[model samples]
Target: MPVLQTVTRETFWTIGPVGEAAFYYLAAVAILVFLYGVYARISEYAAAPADPFDRLDDLPGRVARATRLLLSNEAQFDRDTYAGVMHTFLVWGFLTLLIGTTILAIDMDIWTKLLGQPSFFVGRFYLSYSLVMDALGLLFVVGVGMALWRRYGVRESRLWGKHTDLEDDAFVWTLFALGVGGYVVEALRILGTGFPDFETVSFVGYALALLGQEAGISPATAETVYAAVWWSHSLLALGFVALLPYAKPVHMLTSMANIVTRDEQAGKRLPGVPADLPPDEIGTGSVDDFTWRERLDQDACTTCGRCSSVCPANEVGRNLDPRDVILDLKAYREERAAGEAEEVPIVADGGESVIDAESMHACLSCMACMDACPVDIEHVKQFTGMNRRLTESGEMDPHVQDAMMNVFQQGNVFGDPARKRPEWTDELEFEVPDAREEDVDLLWYVGDYPSYDERNERVAQSLARIFEAAGVSYGILYEDEQHDGNDVRRVGEEGLYEMLVEDNAAAFADAQFDEIVCTDPHSYNTFTHEYPEMAEEFDYPVSHYTEVVERLVREGQLPLSPALGQTVTYHDPCHLGRMNDVYEAPRDLVRSTGATLAEMPRNRADSFCCGGGGGGVWTEVEEERKPSEERLREAVEDTDGAVEQFVVACPMCTTMFEDGRKTGGYEEDLEIVDLTELLVEAMEAAAIDGADDTGRTGAAAD
Candidate 1:
């Protein structure tokens, strides 16, 4: 019922003369080792090629944000709730314990020695500090216990891979030992010193001490046990610090630095290949090719495996393992740094190289891994850089090459005639103006799929209808428009992507539009996210069609009444949902159709990819089942048989689901349609029903 406020306590309560002197010797050695480890790791980062953090602006803001994120681990908690709670407890506990030790050191070495100044760790402050520190130590143990359970209890956990790795095991337990051992020293000290008044403050220690008394241990023996345990705890702590340079446990020190200095780029920014890559440079051939931030990313990994758990490639049984890639890179880099002559394990890890053409081709660039990663390692960026070099070497996936060739031959990836892009527009009841022909409010960037794919062309037409209904003045580039280069850069053909960016920028310049609106999320992501530097003068706002439709419906510009009343499910396109944060718009548009929106388990930021992003649609993944089919099955399962439609916004997603329906044999079970199609149907139905109501009311009155 009462809180233990504070009490006076000696700083070095248990240590004998030898033990007291031994502490300084061990600490000095630990300090030297820690400095060496920090320096060596710093040098490794300094030598890296890309330092994304260097480009960050708003220093005060970045620092303040970093402080909050690092202290609270809120970013991790936002997505991974259970683990976040565990980690938050562990991190804060360790910090509080460290503060306790520092304050004790100050009491002994600084405050007590200062003339006329009383030590802060006395009376109420000491009792409260001791109690909080004891509680935090228990908290630390609980967190570590949960981590152990998670790593071992779950059969298919990503953490098992790291735990099973023989090399990291010792380091893992060493840190674990340091965390759990401190309490042991405290218990013995309390039993020997007979600190009954302080029992409430260090209750965990008191409990253990009580057990020792019941066992009939004498005070003299308890003193001996206390000294022995104290020395062991101190030595282990020193050893843990010393082992930082030799083990992955260094993440405890480096992850915070990496978190604070993390880059400004997120899901929106893909790694761009500079035209000026060194003539002899082989991308990711060694760790040096990566930037300091990326190399620092290696040290930042906690072996939590959150990234791999959400990775679509791994989910679909692809050879690419996001977690393994980082671990392999760290191991190989360390080997190389140690001057071993063996070829770097980076290009090939085990039987398969994560950087190999086969593995590299499997990535969807969906940002699922990045979204799930607590440490914020740029897995996609690193993989894409390697894939790009592989493409330059003519080692790209064959299906992807065909698509790239299509871009070269035609302005789009479909290799269809440029004139056919706008042919679908002829069927529209109203004229969709040409941006190149006249000034318009929005320039519609008809990407490769909607312009040519028969399935998506209809969706594009439906979207145009919605625009017309909203009284939007929109136009298209028609034959002049080119691909937005999102997937091109993702597929690692930076050279070709640049050509596409330049061509599209030229067409955009020629088009007299106030802003850019696109049906394809890939184009929307690139034009707004990736191409501002390319088109500086044409600084028009780039937005996806769902955003436009959602706004129109919200503003009463597009009247809609739910007609079908069918239960609908929405599939978030990776580019649109996770990458661009456009989850709400499509959902809004779907609900406006009077359709009940059923949600699959993995929606919003956790949305499953349709398996078309990062040119996955063009690549031949060797999985028995594609992600899109699995996603379709998930939608079906979530709806419990009532869902009438699966609504999507991205054209690539439309095509992926269409093909998947046939391949997965779900053609009769579900239907895939665009969000715009639903909105259009709802708007037209509202119009017809309004007119019918007017006529019926007049007839009744007459």
Candidate 2:
């Protein structure tokens, strides 16, 4: 193959004014269309504002973080090797091609006239640039090929079933043809015209031209073919632009936007419910209660099924599919666009040819979907919002309604008297402070479960022992504490959650605690992250017990006697680990006991839910086999030959694991303990009991 030189300015000018005008007009129209798409997207956001100021302020940080994530090695996965490599190539290739196009437009339309001639930059560099682009296009085609094969050939790739496979095939094939055909056309032009300046670098084109000559095509006919192919290729490029906004290709833009606008506090423990919220203004209680950005999350879902694949609930035969939830929202949007007369039932799930109540209730509200989604669609938040809609506006199931009523009337999910909240503290030797008279530095927010549940009181006592051993300044709300309503909120009792938040907030406001520590991850998550928005709310720093233990260990306030000599696996409480991103603190606390930390295949953000979140702790949903049983099996299997002890940080997780172990027939071999329990053991082993460990103590005993 003979390498051709690029064209000179005079030669470029003679390429025909009519063809140039067509290119310019098409470019202008494409730009206008792109601008209109941007306008529509922005307008949609404008209609709903949720934490706009926070999102805006966090934008730069999110971009930097997302870029780092994209470039970093952390996102690599062995199973999706082809998809990952191809996606990276496509992203980089498209970015460079867009830059090349912009430069081409400016050089041809603006720079040439202003400077009295198009600079040699484009022609001299065009061959090399085009060759690189052509190579990338080829890579993109390969990527598309693999995607198609995965969709059609591999039954396990769930991404195939959600959307039409043919649509994907068409989209991929079209892109491939455009890239290959465009390169071929351009190469033909260079060959038919003979070697021009800087044409040597167009490797693919040069190869094609040589191949053409070898086939004995006449130069005149080749020139005609070249021109026709070139026009067709350009038209295809233009067509892709017009089709982008309506097709899955739109994810190229929305994905980045989704990443940029992702919630910064995602995975962090939600703060405790505020202490001073008025009765009327509390938790989200209905469909209209959601913030606008939460609704925007519906549009942002890419329907990748990453959430579904990782969802513990869905994997264990639960009816809730996170992917389906997002798809339903997209379907709902499509229906709205079509101006369909029928109201698409948002909660139906097929038996009635409608979304069903079980589909919504089946969700454990684990937040696993949120953790797994690449674009950061807030699946847990969306599910919670829908739950509010069904439970508060629509009539809820009888048991669910009963549970909510119990929480509302009795201040506990179990319909127990509020005064029983202090009963757990009687087992401790120390006299815990009441919120009314205590000037404690830390207010232990004893949640309903640990306070009343027979097995959970041990967790509370363990927390107290750890607090005393660490010489920390802490006290408890004792009798003054009420249910924080996390269960009620998850179970769809918005009014109860609000009332609970108000009552708890009032107690805290009247008390003298500077900080709040919670034994329950659910309470910690809600109080630390979700409570401050209520009117007249006083913001308090809330810490999970593990976080407090970690802090104490770091400060050298608490000392371990010796290694526990036990191999233990840690289970992530969804609310604590996924919702609040408190994964490390608990693990760090576990390690502080000098116990060997073994991981389940699903640990940290990928951890399985214990089937006791989102008020599932209180409501009864039928399962072929219990979700806890499935989770326990996974835990036991992960540690089948190695570890016998499973340490959990959340009260609900503790309860679920205990029950799951019994159900799964592993109860005799496995032991489940709260993180604080291990810390208490470590303290006892060291024989370093503080004064309060054996006697009644004041708020400042530590």
Candidate 3:
């Protein structure tokens, strides 16, 4: 009766009217629900204040970045190898299954119906497709199994029950059930139709068919059972689609969107707040004030704890965990939307705001969380925005409030006299040029800490000696230098930060110098990255001291011994290394010191913070174990007791670790020397080796 003598195949393969109608109905409903979920979220996001999504500029570049983060899973895998591979399997399996479903649609709806073909999807090509799909389906099964094991089986990890609750558990189980159900429906189909050559390619299906055969299920009876399963599997698939909006699965879409739309400066760029704001608009007071991208950050979080895990504050048991702050904001947004929020500062009885004031102020603003986040969620910006709200509401932390007033009154964080700035230079051997008096090749922006802190003053003097021996005509702002405001802005003292920036920019404009150089990374980042817009006259090639010293060494201006026996480890300043990407310059400077370089477990972009960033040097953290101490332990262990010198390039880093070695009881073995000090020693040695009585090099003699 059949036109083709086949044991198993499908043109519509006798899919009865009832089965066909049910499948189409469920599918249509699934499509409608999925579309509705997507459209509603998109509409809500689009309604946020205009970013004028530049749809065309570097679109290909944007797509490539998305493909790396999403399609390639670069960020995910780069952090956690096992979890990355596990996630990859799930992603590939899902994509393959979706493709198979699409192909089936094309074969039936277009090939057979539209073209009136005898039918394809039947021979070797079909067999290969079937085999591939079955293997991939098994891959999906394995992935789900692994997820269950990782989520429930593993007891030590924080992966499952710690942050995720019963709802998350339900989501994973539902997903696995749907995946496993697919094969049950397939195996039943193959048995119901009388096994054939193509069915042999479906290994999972064929194996299950053998079990059914042992049970003595006749082909006709098998068909009857398949009819029931066919509807059940279809309904589950439909339900999975319908659950997209209300579950953790929603990160699938949101995370991808967040990565692709990541701002040009890689999530470090924060939108500048207007100086003049209506009373209510002073800060990001509520969800309505958040830009759409910020809202997307709340939705996109994978709750993986990568951000929270790396946060210095969180690591030290401080009140803030960046990840929880985002989650709290999301919950707070929901509560407000439902008109459930009823209290000032949103502490309804107690929990008014998503993140309370103490936790909000505890953030280091170190950007560690930003670097750790795979999805490019800017936790620092959001935390700082909330800090803005707290500062304006007069609920600012007492210490930060004191720091702000100190900056206003003394033009420095320490509340020391402004005249104390140039005092460090008086200790330098050579007469240090003051830019206000004479034109110089470089204007050294002596930072607050470098100018006044006793330990940091020696580091600043080392910089001056290196510059002098290198024959660079550099000068300092001396007493004219204002507090650079990098930390001030980070502290959310925007009013004082603006005043400082304006004052400092005016100082720069008045000074005569070819380039700007800073001994402190914080001031360097602020001058080079943050101060340009406020003062157009502040346009100069600003550089950090390490970079300038490295350049001098490269040009043979600063000759080095190039052969030493000390094992040295360089600590990358978060601002110098991660923020500005100056990892190699410092390392190269260390290399020229002729010391054997020993890296700690985490170095460069992955370098652990020294707990002195984000105004951290000024903020008092009362943790039993400090982050710098942790780093010192790492350095001691990583070098296996061989390291004699722990070199640092930033003043904050020198101060942090120099203090840490003592407080952490590591001072016995560790000596934290400035990178500039190392360079100065090496140059002096090279000068000794090459000089006649005059103490000048061959190049200088010419």
Candidate 4:
């Protein structure tokens, strides 16, 4: 039998007797460099203060959610699947390797004393553990190999293509080679030095030793090769550590840290601005206005394109790319950090270009990117803040200025006078409240579309009939309600949104209503989540029409009769579903009407936008063809011929669907109705008398 070679006895002095001294000095220098880089970056982020840390006390909950995200299937279908998997492997494997190296750093006698003799059970267990770690390290190398190949060989890989410069590719390749070479060296050491006297841990290394023997290489030669490889591996790993904070690989540490510090309820809309905040101090007007946490998010972006992949605006050929927004912000910050004084130019594929224009304006503010992001970066809120900057700073575009003026002067995007708001309700018999009067049970905020558009007026009429039939005490604002300014804010008019919120809040402050409900999801979202600061001052709850309807149905106050057995698919309005998580209430209301709900594959939080959100309903896209036409085709396909009707709860969705129905030539086959309209039909069938039912003297006998 071949004599077992020992690693301790096979040492060679390549850099003289001072080699160990040189290694220690080098390691210290690398650590200092890395620490300095981290300190600088963190200080830059700390310059901006964020929202008060309400989440700091929720550490356990944050960890639990993060663990679920890591272990669950939420990340399986991501565009960067391979990259993510490889990154995971590298993280876990490298950690284990660090433990192994620490063990090697200590005296063998000390390790034996702590773990017991090699023949003892605890020692054997550790040996098995190390062997398993070796296997994991090999697996990690294979994953890295796949990543390298994808980066270099696959031309279409978004991570590696022309979008990535050579520096990025070099960074990735160096990290890959370092990880692979480190493990290879360890395996060789195990084979050449069987002095540790553990068979299982040395399994692969022993096998390699036999192959070397068969190749006629002497035992001493193999040992020497192992030492060289080991040194090279250690040196390369040290280099990687020093380079980390400056490269994209910094995400390895920061992503995990960000995850650890992630908000327990990440996508929730933050409480609305405080009503007491002085109007002069209320708006975010520049990059200087971003909070620390927000800036951390800007730095934490991995640029994986997950946001872009799911962006409705980008998919529909709009100039906005959520990923690019983050990249630009980060790049700009980095330039600022490097003492660059020149303003960064904003460029996209289209002729559309503007310097200092908030990238937020181009965004639909849909929140799809937040849903799709693996890191849970809050793009919607950040975008909103940017828009706040442009508007509050008085640096808005001419078009945005015009739109805001229309909303402020006319109380509608169409620039129609506020007097026309009550024109739609003229044909109705019941009395609607002024909304600015004393409190009532409910306040109906009739948005511009239902008030002005002829086709949408029918929806308003349907809502009035349903309210009357449900026996619910409700009253509309009629001429008293304003536009609410969701579109104004989305179109980069923060001043207008602020003006609208303050105006609406004042109207509600004097009113006696316990809750405010609206037919338009845009108005509903702005009221429920955005206007809370103002609403809280008035002590009122802002709810969507669907939420109120769902509440009524659950309380057994509204008797719904199943008359329309038509199969219908519910389209999620971006504002209602993604912005406020009002997905279930609308569907529940539809189900209450006895319609079989056919859900689109993309429903709820992941639902595709109707191309009518974020003020797109008012602004013309000037496209060769309208985006709603495509969305209608998708909705029609999702319906699967179950019935003729498509249910919508948003005025914007109604308009988009109607246009889609016309453009797709499905006018003869399909009809779109708001959820309120469907509920009215059910109410009419039930014959229940509501508080305002003037025509009906008595409830029909059941």
TM-score of each: 0.94, 0.85, 0.92, 0.82
Q: Write the per-residue lDDT of candidate 2 for residues 1-702, one digit (tens) a residue.
A: 122333332323223788878776886797678778767766766765354235656667888987866544134242346557766665565666677777766776677767678464444365566667667766666666665566667744667545545656667777778667856776677667774545556666667777887888666767777656777777788877876766667776776677777776653323223447553334343233335566556666655677888777787787778877776666655566567635544553343322466777777777777777767787765665556556645546667777677776777767788788778878788776565675877888878778889899898878877777777788777666777766666655666676788888888888887888888888887787656754267599988888888888988998776558888888888878767778888888877778888888877767788888876665566666677777667767766456768888888888887887887788776798888888888887666445444555555476
Order the candidates by TM-score, highest first — what do you get?
1, 3, 2, 4
Off by over 4 Å in 2: 1-82, 113-115, 122-124, 131-139, 153-156, 190-200, 207-221, 266-296, 348-354, 433-435, 535-537, 639-641, 688-702
Best by TM-score: 1
lDDT of 1 by residue, 1-702 (tens): 124334565546667667677788889889898889789878877666655436356767767877788788876786577778888878888788888888887777677766546677666777778789889888888887776666666643677774357655676566578777887777777777775676667888888778878899777788877767777878887887787765777787777776667665665776554557763353565656768877777778878778888887888888878888877777667767787746642453225443556677788889898888776777877787677667666677788889889888887788888888888888778887878888999888878888888888898888888888788888888889887889988887777877888788888888777778888888888887778765576577988888887888899999898786788898888888887788888887787778988888899998988889888888766569998888988887765557768888888899889889889988888788888788878888999999999999999999
* Candidate 4 lDDT score relative to the true structure: 0.68
| Candidate 3 whole-model C-alpha lDDT, 0 to 1 | 0.78
User: What TM-score does prediction 4 earn?
Assistant: 0.82
> Cα lDDT of all candidates, in order?
0.78, 0.69, 0.78, 0.68
TM-score of 2: 0.85
> For model 4, how does the per-residue alpha-carbon lDDT over 1-702 read when each residue is reduced to its tens digit?
113222122223333447766777888898998999899778866677655445456778777877776544355345456666765666566666667656654433344546564422235445565576677676666667766776667844345322356667776688678766754654456555542565446565555656666787665675778757767876887888887888887876666556666554443343345557565444454356567777777767776677887887777777677877776676666666577745432322223432235345456667789878777787776666655545555655556567668888887876888888888878888765565654568888888889888888988888876676567777767666788777676655655677787777776666777777888888776665556644458455678888887888888877777666888888788778877778888888888888888886677877778777665665555554456666666767765556567788888788877886887687876688888888887786666434436445445432
Question: In candidate 1, which residue ranges exceed 4 Å CA deviation?
Answer: 1-7, 50-56, 113-120, 154-156, 278-282, 344-354, 639-641
